[model samples]
Target: MSLRTGETIKFRSVGERTEYAAKILSADEDTIVIETKPGARPELSAGQYVILIAAETNYNAQIMSADASQVRLRWLRTDKQEYFRVDDFFPVVARKVEKNLLDTKASMTVTFSKEAIDRSPPDETIHPKLWDLLVSLDEKLNLILDRLNLEPEPVEAEPQQVNISASGIRFMIKDKVEQGDMLEVKMLLPTTPMVSIVAYGQVVSSECLGSAGYVVAVQFVNMDSEVRDRLIQYTLNRQREIIRKQRQLE
Candidate 1:
């Protein structure tokens, strides 16, 4: 995606090895200018590379200049050999997507009850006692579903690798999927206070990865901002933990 003025962009500081977000101040065909805070000396120097994460794609950019007011970056094309090495410096595009639970029992129960109620006789075929029992059962199921912390059911027996972030998810699937196919993705984030996000996505890419398995990438469509923020926060926390473990080992 083209960088627009006032759009927030993420890049890593080559020196500090820390990621920072900046707002684009202006952009042209050759270079894009981003605002920098005063008193914060630039951590990136001219000719150094920083990975600019644009949506699902990452771009390797060379720093042209760094000043108190702004920093200029020249984007490199994907055809460049150095562009492929961008992930070596910063793996911003590689996100962890663990297979997770997707609870649909409540919804299923509701649907089943509705069907049962509709099929029941209007006045005489079903006994009053049986009708009362059905009503009681429906009430009980609803009570169970109304809980804040509902027991989750695993969608798969074992976890599969799914590259995921707040923005989207990419996972292997055997089922045929077409580009732009709409899907309702339900996932449970295995974090403290366990967040459940039910998001809709459109299949962006699906390629056969061999053995009848297809790797499908889906982009979230009109997702709630709050859930997206929570996913982002969860990813950040996981990254921190990974960094801490690496430091300990070193």
Candidate 2:
């Protein structure tokens, strides 16, 4: 298997379950070199066996050399897994789903579609003439609103640091939520087009952090293929940006 420089890979010790992300610095037919966070250095050492995952394909490797910033591994062979996981941070807002809401699934679907449409910019290429007319109408509406001293309230939530994967998310919030409670989560991915995603998640864990608030872990449900693809792309893009910034600091 060939690995590209600066590409992100996830790995963990064969005996351990936790996975961590690393950037490939170089690769060859038999060996690959990667840079990981300093905290990971302790878990990896010469002769330690690990499982490395790249683009959903798994490989067996034995560590040749390990240090605070880099690890060299001798690739043993290739393996397979059903899926791969990647995680990163983004701005997120989550609220508990009230049980009394009727037709919850339909309501959530409509809300998700509307949020996506409202946040996305108008595509001028779809219908140029109609786009022009809509732009003119919007301008007139804004003018009328300005004359009436009426303005729409900002609905965007304040950006919060949220660790998110395609399957789940972890964030800190002030409200207490019990395990198994469902929540409506909305997040904005700071990508080229700034994608907005709305999904529902079930609370898996919630731990109080005293004055700081509570740390909540939620697993997403009812996610469609398109949203999952967007999440995977977002993670890959975020990994690239992180690696680029790390190189600049070197």
Candidate 3:
């Protein structure tokens, strides 16, 4: 879709999932100049990514600049890139999934398991809680195997801080991994069923955390759709919990 000047489009900041309308000032194949709507404040920063969605089509773009008057955006994709103008940028609802990706503490484990590792089935084909029980049994089995000097399935130590969402995760590790390294991530979501998701992620960014360790960030390169939906639901529930706690305190 091509948008002309004076047209508005929906805009969303990637990190915070903040949404707002922006009127187009000028546009081309790759870049667009949009005017932020009056009285609407979008906390956008340069170098951050944003999504511009219109007519059910979404375009990912990088924020070049933003001020009271206008925001500059550069399209992230070359293929299927569309121009926009002359439409009202409406505020889009926050993505519950993305919002919960913020840094949080959780019981998570990360490891460099083989990429093609075979997935174990059904955990006794019982309830979700039963599945967790099966996992505990498996852990006990591993411990037994260890005492016998047998090489059991490797399990890493529990992660201290796991910043996760359906899209990716960031955590601190003792060893530094090169950017683009692929690893397996297993996360136990504290939901009703307490879902356990095993997925593969590619290291996107890594930095030294000084005396603590190295902070590594990974983007989910592969995951099941159902698993992603569960993450969204888990995050939404977490948000409600925080609000409830605050109300009690007040």
Tens-digit per-residue lDDT, 43-162, candidate 1: 666755566665756554557888776889865332122100000110111112221211111111111222334435469978978887676555434433432231354223123566
TM-score of 2: 0.46
> TM-scores of all models?
0.40, 0.46, 0.40
Q: Each candidate's lDDT (Cα)? A: 0.54, 0.65, 0.55
Can you give the lDDT of residue 245 in candidate 3?
Answer: 74
Q: Largest lDDT belongs to which candidate?
A: 2
lDDT of candidate 3? 0.55
User: After superposing candidate 1, which stretches have Cα over 4 Å from the reference?
Assistant: 1-157
Residue 70 alpha-carbon offset, candidate 3, angstroms: 34
Q: Pick the candidate with the highest TM-score.
A: 2
lDDT of 2 at 185: 73
lDDT of 2 by residue, 133-243 (tens): 565444433332222211144344545677776666888877888765678776666543346677776675789989888899876655666887777777777778778
State which candidate, 1 or 2, has the greater lDDT.
Answer: 2
